[model samples]
Target: MMSNRWLILADDLTGAADCAIAFGRRGLAAAVTWDVTTSGDVSPDDSRPLPVLAYDADSRGLSASDAAERHRGLLERWLEPDRVLFKKIDSTLRGQPAAETAATMAYLMERTGAAFGICAPAFPATGRTTLAGHVHVAGRPLEDAEVWRRDHTYASANLGFVLGTAEIETTLVPLSAIRSSDLASRLARIAEGGPGVAICDAETDGDLARIAAASLAVAPVPFFIGSAGLAHALADTLAPAPTGAVHIPPSRSGSLIVVGSLAAASRAAMRRLAAQDHVVHLPVSPDTLLGDLAGRADLAARVAAVIAAGDDALVEIAIGDALDMSLGPRLARALAEALDPIATRIGAVAATGGETAAALLARFGIDGIRLVDEIEPGVSLGLTLGRLSIPVATKAGAFGDAESLIRISERLRAVRTQGSFS
Candidate 1:
């Protein structure tokens, strides 16, 4: 059960980075892939010694069937004899967790003759916890959160009900049992009992630690299914020791901030970051970027010029009074395109939102990223793979506090002054 190889699959870039950071924090070399098409070009042996490979399936916006199929294919291609499988679900359950988990279960059963999956999506550090089989955010039901309220497909926050719809059998491990001395034996029994998913309840890091311990103690190591929280617990118990302090040399120039998420938190953070005297705020509207090619070019030039002048630039998608969900993806791609002209000039790229980060990095031909640090509970900082070696920071659209953007900007600046990404 104690192995360094891990195939961590996530639905998007942010999810991939957050989960991978759990291992990186433990001193294990972890990388989050951006493009799956070129995944074959890199082998597990080709990466860092005993590396943790995290792939972004990019299936968040796909249909349940498509997402499931995508994960199935990934498992077929990447799952190896010695590698452990970790399916990273969104902490807030934003993606098709039940369908994808079922897909993972099917593949694991076929490949390893395993029949059970240990499901624990609680990320206590970010206010996401599970209790009595339901997922809660900040003490409220997940569906009650702004993200789910705006766009949700699940009938309820109950993990059992959600997975039941996908025909994936599940069992709940309550907190009471988790805190008890018999917890380890209970989990071992569950593993030996049958093939199904175990939905574990956890309100704190301690609960997750117990679940992880019990999992490893079992005969057949169950497939792990959860967010960064579970990953953290597993990393602490299973991953190798750190090589050294996690450090990335600072950027030589000012950093670039791209905000394309429509989440209220992102919008508010941009406002606060834009007001900083040292920050140069360049707002890009979706309409102009989509329709006005010349104007888009002009904006890109200005953003590049500002960075060249050693001034940090905040290039954000302009959101109007009316709420238009359709504009989100388009604006994300547009903003990324506009910044393509100055990708190299950017000392570091700090993006908010998975779509935005993916679009922007793909433009620069970045195929993957090596995670090295965690800026906060939900924010991960790393260096881009392939041609670009610059430090990069990624945050989920709805994650982080009001000053998250500010904190990223400051971190990048500190690195810039430090000389090099270690």
Candidate 2:
């Protein structure tokens, strides 16, 4: 019952919501819930559209069985094909409650027979709202300001659990890493300088009012919710600004880094283009950010130590295609081809045009084996010779597990737009 279709069970409500938004964008009707307090409810149709549901903030702390039963009711209500049912839970190996979250997952998976995946995103030694919230990202002279930044806002690192009765397996790798160029570019574009608008949870209805206010505050170019779906929704909900386009007015944004998954990064970049006509080819990755054994000590640990100390660092690594290309290429191409074998293939010679992506390359494969003599599939390398210049977060493109790629991509795009560093 659970092996055929794709079932996605998000570890946390936000993960569920975000994954649903991803589905909605693909034209599939989906719903997401954050409040997990009580089990029985149609879920909130406000923060999200009908196809996209959000849990009431108050209903987020229910017993696992109770929550699971309620979710069953919700799914029974939405008995439509191509419809998604999500339950996000946090796990505690040491405790039963979090494990109860896992119980909720087990129930949804067995009952719905939906194909899904799970993601748990947590920042152990990081600061502020480790997961989801406003992050006052500053670089260089702002080390002392992180305290200020945290005071001003926080982020949510609540576990992202995505599960469905689908074939997609959940393999989450904690890769809180990104390229420098990617990070720097991200900050610049997002702030766009001056008091820009901040759109919170635009994936839901109440968020619309929030955006309206944000628009009023920022005027015209409202800073939209970070994810692509919310951005699209905001653009649709608001009257086309005088920028002349149905989209947010184009910005003379400096540069932006497209991090995370290539597909997500590419979509984020494409969505934010005020000047869509202007061809902007952001660099993408087909590897891990903190994957495999090498990443832990290789890049992640090194960067974590630096940033924790309030120092800056930046690391660069080369990426290419497989079959005479690079390993990331081989893995990316394999996965993409599996998703859709009809994808076009580039020759062994030149770069695959200016714009390269993780997803598109995933048409090939994403798993590369590492051989000391030769860096092949399933292999990663690290070099830490550079000065601790800027508090840097370096990760191989393939570091994060499968489903997390989307969120990772969103984060990368956000950081890139913020242009915090360069």
Candidate with best lDDT: 1
Question: For model 1, where is the 10-residue window of minimal lDDT?
Answer: 40-49
Predicted candidate 1 versus true structure: per-residue lDDT over 9-60, tens digit per residue: 8998998999888888877778888565655334433754545788889888
- For candidate 1, what is the total of clashing residue pairs? 9
Query: Model 2, which residues run further than 4 Å from truth?
Result: 1-49, 55-57, 86-104, 112-115, 120-170, 176-422
TM-score per candidate, in order? 0.94, 0.23
> What RMSD does each model have against the real structure?
2.2, 23.7
Q: Which of the numbered candidates is closest to the native, going by highest TM-score?
A: 1
Error of 1 at 391 (Å): 0.6
Q: Per-residue error at 278 for model 2, in Å?
A: 44
